[model samples]
Target chain A: MTALEYIRCIGESWPTTKERAYFEALALKEHGRLSPEHVPEVYHFDRTMSLIAMRYLEPPHIILRKGLIAGIEYPLLAQDMAEYMAKTLFFTSLLFRSTTEHKRDVAEFCGNVALIKHTGQVVFSDPYRVSQYNHWTSPYLDQDAEAVRKDNLLKLEVAELKSKFYERAQALIHADLHTGSVMVTPESTQVIDPEFAFYGPMGFDVGAFLGNLILAFFAQDGHADQVNDRKTYKEWILKTIEETWNLFHSKFIALWDEHRNGSGEAYLPEIYNNADVQLLLQKKYMTDLFHDALGFGAAKMIRRIVGVAHVEDLESITDVSKRATCERRALDLAKMLLKERRKFQGIAEIVAVIRQF
Target chain B: MTALEYIRCIGESWPTTKERAYFEALALKEHGRLSPEHVPEVYHFDRTMSLIAMRYLEPPHIILRKGLIAGIEYPLLAQDMAEYMAKTLFFTSLLFRSTTEHKRDVAEFCGNVALIKHTGQVVFSDPYRVSQYNHWTSPYLDQDAEAVRKDNLLKLEVAELKSKFYERAQALIHADLHTGSVMVTPESTQVIDPEFAFYGPMGFDVGAFLGNLILAFFAQDGHADQVNDRKTYKEWILKTIEETWNLFHSKFIALWDEHRNGSGEAYLPEIYNNADVQLLLQKKYMTDLFHDALGFGAAKMIRRIVGVAHVEDLESITDVSKRATCERRALDLAKMLLKERRKFQGIAEIVAVIRQF
Candidate 1:
């Protein structure tokens, strides 16, 4: 569906039957399963608008935002997230492995992914010419505004990253998989609000999740007064990052080992040979993704500070010195995201270092 | 007329009526007299061929080549050539000094001047490519046929120099005043073959003359023995260069002082008193012309050696060392042309130094 149509459908309970159909076909091809319960049912209200209704999965679950606020740290979270992303984005997709003709077809399809294009346009294009959004604001910022905005944009651009991560096939991804989008607990995790879903670099989803947690940790300066408590909170942020990466890596490897159709003679024996080769290839792909993640994370951080809907993290700090300090730290982290992207082996390492700063 | 028609006209006659008419108008503006005898007449015999007819002023008025062969030399030759060029190109015609509208008309008239484009089609075009000249039949050339042919093609692109030289309206120049086109005597020098005459930069005319002289000097080794008359021959070449520039500068300044129409207003008071600003402006113009002459001269020299048209001076040197030495010296002169172009204060100084090199 077109961007305007999608937005109208979301706001006015219009039907999105055609959009759901397209996603279902794609999901079946990529995931080998069509989760009807997870996808929306669409009904046309008018030629230009549609209503989308879905089975909203509730918790024993918590959105990523609530989890961040509640300090609900998960084990090996960063590793698990990275592994899920690498497998989903690279090995399983036809984009990196397909014939030229098939790759072109997929590229064309992904190019028109409306949600991705729409969000980018809304964020980057002039608001006077484009339909203004609540999040739209001038990127030309003052000293404080400039600092935060630049930090975010730098994270998104990843100017210093050694390798590009956009060569892989972009599937229909839940692009905004931040705290508010994810509903999770200790044993079970549920993702909701797929309205912002689109085909994009998988690093985007990973970056959003990690970026919001970093934001919350910095916001603690205004929220908590005890110096000792602040140090503990900071440690928790580092632990959460390390645990996320470990969990994501273990889970992804297990999935690949159990489900892969390795006939021991399938195509590309050279790539599939031994554990060392596999690890090397995986490491290269992970490193590239880390750079892209840093760039996207910076973009999100900057937008929240100078964008129209300012975040409460720095705004809540009331005192200019305290607020500036929080912002300077966030900017520093964002800069590090771009400058040290290649050095980061896993999400845990990056998160661990960022929280300490 | 188109390029084809122009080439056809030059190939068929001694004096081109059209060429004469064009130059006569220029002469009338400068000398306040129209001497038809001084210009060639142009005529079209067919769509593909035409001819020129004119008084072939002969004997004591020998072409520059005959004098070179006889080991005779002229003093201040470069200066004489530069004045002739400056007078013809800048002063005599509306070619360089014309308004935009007038310039457009003149440019259209001279559109067929590019020799390379016309030769390219005749030499390399499909269906009727000329193969007779493809073989390395030149007993004098040490290089293979393909290398020589490629070098020749490169030299042809030097037509680009026209654009650079044409921007400054410094003189009414006889655009092709090489040795073959001029007839000279001790008392007077009459520039013949006005077919290539156009409103162009003063340096083009100056460069063409100096460049041809350099070519002639280099070709002397093939025409004469280095052991028998090398020292005396070299001295003559050097003197010719020094004398050429001196005469050209003296004549140019004389003309400016006698006829310049400035009303005692200074354009460059810092360089000269306000009362003689026009003379200073003229001097500045001559300096610029010298710089351009140097650049074009260098390009012309380099193109002939590494490019096409192997000079006879090096051709006589059977030993590669001697030939390469001559080539190296020529190149050094060419480089000096480029490097010291801006520092040149007068024609005599440049000519004198270049002769030593």
Candidate 2:
């Protein structure tokens, strides 16, 4: 008989204080109850201690990033991720709750300001400006990082995203949803490490996951050898990116359609009544979300290569010259995506661009 | 010795509870300290008793709306109001403070949800749909009320504004900043009755003031009789509207410029260093704010006409037919403003439109 195993996860944050961790445990336990299918169950939480007792995934379950690095393919990854993102984001948004409930939750999560500030600093602000924390592949990518600082248009887009992240209480997001934050087997996917969870733009969450995957795909070139060319794996990565966005779009719309008559004050049934109106709103909303995701995803990618926190997928490549080449390709694409995201329409076009690179 | 008079104001809202009043008092005490020049000075606050004891304006400081109805003018009205709006809104926004400070204050003010709900329903919701509370000049405005319910394009725009009202935590706004909210004289202007205060879109506050002025302008026709035709007074009102917006725009930009190197995080100085970029951002910000004010102003106008609360300017007119004629013109202009506000670039165009109406 399968039994439960408990794991103690204590909060140790940047300032070496329990505050951020307390919020992390609180966020996981708080939002985990809302959607339990993909998130790990929180067994116990001690606020003062900044400790959390959660489920222990067995050895067979590896971090999604590591699996990607090993050229492993999880066929159901896109479907599972789409469902996870859609449910977690949709249920927490104004589409599902009244203003009273939404505001209450927003205020409660705003207490997680420590992590939110950290994110606003690292992912949004520090990447563009010269900071002691910022790093890159020296000599090879120095000019590239300098270029990022000087690109006024890219900086302008980033400022918009930064404000959106701070202002839009669109949803309670699992604020850090990179591949390293996910654990999976062939049949199972579990989301974890929501230390940065707060009411932020939903696109930030979607972008984080997709941007990390893009990082992993670029690193595949460095990992390839005579035995494993990793050509099929790279193709799989592109297909997964396309499928994830498309599925999320459809699933998010389906939830909205289902809850059209509920207490959600965003779109009253008396107002958005006709099929044509619904179609119009849906298209407009998805288009905005699509662009938001692309812009944010590109920003996240740029930060990984040039900002403080380097992804293991790139770091583990070992060969500095080859790794820089792969990184430069990702960097150039991210810059394009960040600056010209509005011009992009569908994920297929994005996939086409990836193939070109 | 000059002595100050005091007034005890208790909150008595729709549901007949002390909670809304407590928040009102707290909001006054909390945000009132920021700009006491315009807002009435709060002397005491008893939260449990749901009471606020504030400075009492002596005689000659009549309600601004009553002054407007009597064809009285305050030459300094636009200047004082512009400074008031710019100071209170700017100091409390992310443009003047860090996210940490802003979020903390946002969460604190979210406690005033009772009035926020009342506003969301009456100002934004109930006006769009049928409700027993909604009333108009029966038989005269019956068609106009019904037309509001059937106007799909108008309703679409309302949905957008309503969502913005809910989602955007732009600044601390005097949630009900109508003409009645102010007590004015030839020399001194004292703003009072902030019982419906909370953190909301700045446009809501600015729009409330301007929209009520527009109502007064329309009602000039009905209030006209044998002596004092109110024609010249109406022109002064139009000029006041133009001056108010233009002054507020300049003063707001001045504040942003003054604090560009300060703690405010909206437009970080490092990224937005260049003159060209600053111009681009200012134009974009002011444009969006102008449109938001226009849209919200139009909605406020619509609700006053067809919704539960009828303004004294229109209601005091004895002839129902003549009053309805004025109301119809205001309603038509408001509908156009709501739908076509984006096309407007400056306050001069708006003043021109008001003249045509």
Candidate 3:
């Protein structure tokens, strides 16, 4: 069954009447499957509450965060990720053969994904925002909290300035498909937590995935004990970034070529048909998105270290000097990412430098 | 004689009629000595051209760049620069004890400083509209014309941004007062180049001075050949930056206390009475400006080496790799400056780090 139908089943399984009502409403609103013609079968239990049920599909998957912490490598993982991102973001949003109404429905659904509010606040904010989390935090980590706050403020301001950037409604995006939210295998990847999903910058998804991988790679220094393993682990991280970017670009272009529909034709011309112009546009968009990604990634990395939830990197490094060294390197890389993101042309270039670290 | 009158004398001595007319108009507009009451003199210049001039006090001085390059340290140089900048930028703009008419006249005169225009196939446009000085050309220098073109272009862009920033009428600024422009001795410092001056961000001048000094410090690797003298020379450079920042802050606060006069009361109410608040405001401004300065300095340093005119610093390093190392260090420091500028509260912090390098 489709992802939405599976979510409906989970909602129906909730134990209480209030829970049933809340889930049903949430499933409809959050899933954007509210059309009368498309509504799933509604079941009633003891006449107390109504629920929706549907078949669920399970596929080979692994938690991205677990893989990161464990330093596991799956061949073509970066390539697969880039492809997945390119399809979900660039192809689905920019090249989808969908009607305007269909696209709008997707956007509206993604907007109501309250799971983001729940998870983002819980996982992201609790550790950083509360007083309890402030004490006994890493000293190096604490130094970055004010910076994180300032960065957040800046992003909010940028978001305000570029409000129109998200106005062109498009397909549903798996917004929070970073390491924690994505389940991956060799052949297929399943993205969970559609709550943070939204129609936004296509590059945002691409960046989030690749950025997380980079973060994981950098954090290895905190976890790995062997110097030799550290080198190999870091190599894997750089490789992931490079391959991911390459695969994403290739797949994005292919999808655009294969699915050029007439929708939004008046505003955005057929980008695929004109190779020179298309390449130029793609490079420009990618470059700008990369800069944004770098800034956001720095914010993410810094916040995780100091804001609320500290990473395992520093925790694993028992030696204060080593921990400080790793922290400094991570921060140095983050700062470099933010400042020099524009100067980089492709992910390979950036990954190459990161590898040197 | 006042600075304007001295400049007028220099203008009148120019061999070319075009140059003479330019300076003559400059003197009239800049020096309030030629008043609205002297309608005939003003009208004569008005008919001839639109450029304005002003008269101001002159003092014994020498360019800071020459001193830096030559490794000469005049006593009280740092204190002198701080006083000149603090008095000219903060006092004249915010705490001036002058009448409204006099302030207005000065403001108008500042507003009229000429902008350099890009004419024809010239790649680098002059934005300051200052008459080119044949005497100012470096005989010892061998500059790449194309590189110079590129550097000029970059400088032009910077100058344009600076002018636009000034047009907001934010504060009184000595728009152009680099080492070449400012004349100084142990007892006093005098700013020349009112030709390109305007009201703008006060920090721009601070950044220019400090940034240039930092560049010189880095450049000293080549300038002072002896290992021991190198240490001494580098120490001087570091001390200069530290003292310059310290004196500027101390004198700035002192001036703010003496004559703040309710001008910046809106954003800085407590600043009128609270020394701590004033210090914090100054610190924040300095921090932000330092970042910009580093970025600009990096760009300037890099362009000088790779693009057009090379610094004597690299010239002193005969080995290619060594020179590259120095260049690389400058670039690295530039990036570091951009990245960590916000973290620095005092010049000692910067000097400590530079000394480590």
Candidate 4:
């Protein structure tokens, strides 16, 4: 006999709750065509009750963050994650879809504004202002939090990022792409809980994944004890961040080249046909994307340290002083990344900088 | 007794025809709050018939292009036009409205995509590619038109402009703001026929007005007679172009300052309160806007010369060779503006460049 589970929301956030259910169904249906291996199959959905019944990621499968906290290394984690992000993001982007298809889907997803508004408040707005929702490792990092609230240059960069998040619908994005949303085993990696999906800047997705990995890396020091120094695992995390971005960039460009003459409207082959101009267009596009990813990734990191939500990676550490030290290092790197993201040209440079901190 | 005018459409472009009816009503209703003197009051609208009945700008009122062709100058032209552009654009921008109001209007305008598509084709696509709709002066502009079609650098720039036209929803714009769209007299400047109105980049509206003014300046030599060499009229036109942009910039900043503490969502007062950061934000914003206006204006000029639509300022000239010479000068200047708009820092520089040509 087989067992089935149906999930339902119990509170006032039902509109977004229902929307997430709808989007997950839509995404799973579409992503099924690209690569079905990483998405949970939808069995049934009830829109009125905000209920969903689907495949359960049982037993061996565990949240990636939990696995990371336990110092367990999934060797295939980087490759599987890179493939999932590339296939899901690229397939849903204008780089692959027609304008008609793209706009129609964009309009549909704009109804997910309830969730977007929540993200806008927590990730961009609340951290910079005195808000009831905001918290941190109090007393120990009190001055650091106040400094974040008063940093004019950092706020200026964040304003630009917030505008992009609100206005620039460059692609359909899984707005919350953190490690907590992934379930992993030694042989497989599956992305789950994408209720925050909508048409937004693709950099938001890339940044979330990389930013969460940084959080995990910083938390390693807090997790270290006499038995395992955790130095090697930290190196592995750095390598994973470097490899994921490089692989995703190459894969995205490969898709662009493969579909150069396809239905994508942004760069028409007839106009951008010559080798020289095509190369120029690609370089400019990727450079801008890289900067956006860094800026947004830094924003995500800052919000985790001082904003409404605290990550489990840092919260799991028992000692307050040790946690605060790890968090301050992350905060310092994040500030540098947000203000000086444009100066960075590549992911390897970012990895090198991460090691410096 | 008062008379009434009713317009009815008979064909497939009825959606745009109807949208014009809808927007004129919305604009007039809102514009009434700002300045009822410039925009005509809508009397009646019938959606099924795709019709509008509105106030008529009575005699002595003539299309501004005709007045320019006759070498007649209105002293209040610069002030009146600048006021019109500032009031309409600033009031409709996110600088003045709340996000809820802005998004509602933006979504409503997105339904007017048919007209937007027409603009995308005529203004951006046709000139860059060989299309049946494209027409220019035979023999005189045959080579010039061919050069435009083959100019890779020009097309590349056009592609960027096209993307902005299709993507950036910075403000509500009169997408066809040109001299021909204005009714003028010695005392009054009235804007009419905003049938292509939609939520788009504000620079498009600013550029259209200035680009048409530039076209009128180039056509002065063709209108030159033994009785009137038009040397003084050319200087007046140049002064008007320079004054209009400078005045518009000042007035826009004034509005931003006035409403800095208002519901505007782009730069919140809480974050952008300091003088140094405020100055930086304003300078960066206006500079980008200036470049966008110049680029869009140049694209408008190039289209009028080489694309499906030809401006009356150049077309009214009887001699083909004379018309061709005037057009080639305007085209040369426009191509420069489109390619090097960012290099220009102020309005005086643009006026100086115009004088050089």
Candidate 5:
């Protein structure tokens, strides 16, 4: 007999809870057509009870965030994540899918507006302004939080990204792609809990993963003890960030090239047939995407520092002052990335900036 | 009984024909929420028979194109069109409505894919490539047509615009808003025939109107006789183009200000409450929108000249060579506008270019 993992809403089941259940089930059910290896198989979904039963990872599969906190390295983490993001983002985009099929899904996924609005508030809005739900390391970061509200340039850039999140339906994205959403066992990686899935900018997903990894990297200072200085671990995280984006870019381009003659409606094969024009288009597309990923990734990093929901990486540091130091670094880097993201040409440049910090 | 105008599918009523009837009726039905004066009331719609009945404009309100071709100037044409475009586009956008409401309609309008695809082929695709449906003034425009296909920069710009049209669901736009789709007199303007309506880019409608007017301007020489040189009429057309865009810009801004505290989800009032920030955001928004309008208008003009659908303004010129000359001029202007639209800061600059042509 097969074992099934059931996710049930135990407490008061709000409309949003039920909605997420339905959407998550639909996402898993539809995963077979895309990259199915990293996604769990849906067995049964009971909408009324807000319950979902799916394949269980079992055994050594642990949440990626917990593993990061424990100083564990997954050698295949970057490659696996790159494969997952490239497949999910590229295949669902107009470059690989027909407009008709894409729009239908876009409309359907817009039902995840509950979570989208929540994200719009907590991630993009609340962190930048005074909100009842917002908090940090209290006095240690009080000035930093206030400075965020007063920064006009940061506000302007964030407004641009927020509007893009609301408007651009580039692909079906796994909306909440933080490390906590992934389960890994060195050789295996599984992305779970796609309750927030929707057709949004592909960079949102790419940025989420990269941004969380950066957060994990910053928190390593607080985690360091006598045994491990965490210097090598930090390098590994930066390397992973660089490799994931580089690999995703190449893989996405490869898919575009392979499917140039397919039903993808964005660039007709007849128009973009020549080598020079293809290179130009690819360069522009990837450049814009790279900038977007950096901007959104930075935004994600900022939210974790001061927003309502935060990661365990920084929270685990018993000393509040030390945790605040790590958070302040992440927050400063995020603000800079959000503002000066367009100035960055590649992931290596981003890595260099991180090293400087 | 009130006079009724019934639009019926003529022959071979395909699924697309029935789809158009349903969407057109929905467009007209929804027009009441935005601008009422410029739109005829929808009386009845039959999906099965592909028929629509609506209020009819009186005889004085001749089709705008016919009036333009005959050298008759409607003073209110620009004002009425500006009002129509601003109200319809603003009210239907996330700037004025919640994201949930907006996405529902966006999904519903995805059913208008048939016309959208047809538009993709004719306006954005077929004009720049070889298709059996493509035919210009032939011998006269053979080089011009060939030139369009050969111009790498023009093709690159068009592909960008095409992808935007396919992707950006900014607002509910009148997908076929050429002068022919409008009826007008010296005192009044009434927009009709929204069979191609969908939740697409607002600039598409604005561009379609301006592009057609530009076409009419280019065709005046062919229509010139001893009685009317059309020099003053030409100036009026250019003035109207300038007025329409400027008025739309101001009206759109006014609406945004009035509803700044409303339910618009795109720019939250709480975030953009300050005057400096508000001014900055509006500048960026309006600037991007202006460039989009210009690009889309240029594409519309080029398609009419070289694609499947030829405008009556250019077609009615009895002298074949004369008509060819007019088309060639319009084609040249459109190619320039498409390639260099970003360099233009104001509608007046665009008017200056139109005059130079």
Candidate 6:
């Protein structure tokens, strides 16, 4: 047993982990069923043992965040990710599935409550409150952390987001779909570690990716040295953020158009058959999703700065004062984005806002 | 057997009926756990037989709608109903319950999916689409019904609301809290027929009550005669509507304030401990809730007019043309409310709007 594979053993001690592995296996099975090209094959699953064995994407396939830190850009990353998101999200949602199927899947994923609770605490609650688990760069960023806790507007926005997180089961979300959750190479991008997967707002996954990329862009200043100014890498990160949302919008709409006659209970083909109404429906849907993505992304950013889990993008930056400055800038941007997300019209406006900070 | 008590019996052919009985029992139990006064006592529940035997509010406890139609004013109607709404909604919500308890109840009520589906259709879908189930006062208001179906803005607003109805499980709601569901007299108000209870937006319950009151107001003219004129009764209905919301607002806040230090996971006492932030949080929460209630109430009104079900208020108006006029005014008001609900500031503003229509 030289750790050739990860085995989530069934035991009295790790009931939460055991359940997560089971849910992850179930979610992956569902993902494969919906879109196999985007998912890893489950080699074996033992319900009694609470274990799953899956494929290994060997070397060159590194965590996307590490690749970003190394100033390596995946050419196909945006395109591949958008396809996976549109497919997995559309296929699993009430926009594509029957209510019967949707409710059954929702009920099953409700058992993934532990992972959801973890997210609820880390993303929504802990950051806004004085929590023992919460940490940031000490003294240098102490005031910034306190400001976050004291920002009534920010907490108000977060409270709405938190309620959405706990209550809204819009679709099956890869609840931890940050950059670190992705394994990438120059030509391939694979989503991994969906152990935190559950039925949640699709924007949560979208925000995690985009928000982490923004964090990556900010951290580039710290990662820069004499050898590389990292200016080009920073631009590349920004371009990826813009392109991901743009590509996702186009791809999601294409899927919706393709499935207009499908069994999506949200909009019946008979009712939404008119072109004008269809366009209006899609525009409203995408706009809401965009705002949700921005709001959730900002919350993710804020939490990484002030909540329990710190992201490697900023954490990898060594200088205490320098890292604090970077984190503070990101924090300010996140707070603004979270509060004013509804005012945003498109990714272009968002990119412009990102450039401002 | 002669009906001494309300015994919903089990039957092979009516499995849904059996399930509904069980759910009703569960909801009543939960409601009683929170507040015993407003809800009927569940004496016996036989899961195997799919039956529930509950307390009967005998004699003067006629349906509230009947009281309104007969021009009978319950002096304590506002106080009793508001208390019920505040207590039942607050206690069962994430505001009071832990996430574990909340999610568990939410899941249990999700088993009441059949009723949820009915609401999704009748309240959200049928009014916007040309469904065969849709009906109206025929010839006179055929155009009004057609306008409801054709109004793009109305449908767009409705779509968002529908999604919320399906996705947002903010609290354990009395899904059908219309006047027909209440048994009342001068001294008592008891909510009954919670067979459609489920975890949904609290506004659905609040909206149902207020919207029905609006319908009753509009129908007063049809019920008027030389003997009584019914103008005073209409004024009374308006007063009750106004007071119900005002009182409900105060009572709900009082509950929130009282439990500000409790286990409500929404706003942790540590973070929202500041009086300013707490006030801000409550204001935001209550404002959002008001908009939701208005939107949902408007939807309820619209469905009753042009969707599958017609309320006794409008249906009892013998003159077809007279009835159409009332229905059309209601339809217009509902459309405006659904589209411009966010513009409303408070119960006073809503009352003003109702007077204009």
Q: What is the TM-score of each candidate against the true structure?
A: 0.40, 0.95, 0.41, 0.92, 0.96, 0.96
lDDT of 5 by residue, A1-357 (tens): 234685545256455777888888887676534777788777778888777777888768999999999999999999889988888888888898887888788888877888888777777788876788888999999999888877878888998898778778898888899999999898788898888888888889999999999999999999999999999999999999999999999998999999999999888887676788788888888998999999999999998888888999999999999999999999999999999999999999999998888
Q: lDDT tens string, model 2, B1-357?
A: 122757575536557357666766766665567767677777777766766777777778899999999999899999999988998899988889898998898888777776787888888777778889999988999999988987878887887788778878888888899999888888777777676777778999999999999999999999998898889999999999999999999999999999999999788887678888788888878898999999999999999999989899999988999999999999999999999999999999999999998
lDDT of 3 by residue, A1-357 (tens): 334344233444423434334444443343333222222233332223443443232454567677667777777576656655665555444334333333334323433334433333433343234345543245754555445434433333222212212222234455555777656555444454443554444544665666677667766776776544666867877777777777777776676655545552211342123455455545655565566555555545544554445555455667766676666666657656654566777676777777666
**For candidate 3, lDDT tens digit of each residue in B1-357?**
323432223334333434334533554344223122211123334324433333333444456666666777766778777776666555544334232322243334332333211110011122112223211113222233223323333343333233223222224444444566555555545455544344444565676677667767877765656544577767777787788878977787687666555543112232123454445554554564455444444334433444333455455566655556565566456545643455666667777777666
- Give Cα-based local distance difference scores for all models: 0.47, 0.86, 0.49, 0.82, 0.87, 0.86
Runs off by more than 4 Å, candidate 1:
A1-9, A13-53, A73-87, A90-92, A95-112, A122-141, A147-171, A225-231, A253-267, A270-276, A308-324, A346-349, B1-357
lDDT of 5 by residue, B1-357 (tens): 244575545256455777877888899888755798899887777888777777877777799999999999888999899999999999999889987888788888888887888788788888877889889896998999988887778888888888778778889998899999999889888898887888878889999999999999999999999999999999999999999999999999999999999998887777676899888888988888888889999999999998899999999999999999999889999999998998989998998888787
DockQ of 5: 0.60
Is candidate 1 or 5 superior in DockQ?
Answer: 5
Q: How high is the lDDT of residue B335 in model 6? A: 91
lDDT of 4 by residue, A1-357 (tens): 122454544366465566667776666666655657887767777777666677777768899999999988888877777777778777777567765566566667667666777787788888888778889998888999999988888988898888778766677777888999888888878787777777778889889999999999999999999999999999889988998888888878888899888987677776676788787777877888889889898999999999999999999999999999999999999999999999999999999999888
Tell me how each candidate scores on DockQ against the true complex. Answer: 0.01, 0.59, 0.01, 0.42, 0.60, 0.61
Query: TM-score of the A chain in candidate 3?
Result: 0.70
Q: Per-residue error at A282 for model 4, in Å?
A: 1.3
Q: Is candidate 2 or candidate 6 better by TM-score?
A: 6
Candidate 1 lDDT by residue in tens digits, B1-357: 111223323333333444444443343333222223233223222322233333345457677666665666665344555555545543443212222232333333343233222222222221011243232113423342233233322222222233234222233455555676666665445566544444345666677677767766765554556546655776677666656666666665665554434321111122122344344455555676677776676655654455434444444456665555555556556655654566777656765665676
- iRMS, all models: 24.9, 1.5, 18.9, 2.2, 1.4, 1.2
lDDT of 6 by residue, A198-313 (tens): 77899998998999999998888888999999988888888888889899999999998998899887887766667888889999999999999999999999999989999888
Compare the candidates by DockQ and give the number of the best one. 6
**Any idea what lDDT model 3 has?**
0.49
Q: What shift in Å separates residue B243 of candidate 5 from its native position after superposition? A: 0.3
How much of the true contact map at the interface does candidate 4 reproduce, as a fraction?
0.17
**By summed lDDT, which 10 consecutive residues of candidate 4 chain B come out lowest?**
B1-10
Candidate with better lDDT, 4 vs 5: 5
Regions more than 4 Å wrong, model 6: A1-15, B1-6, B10-15
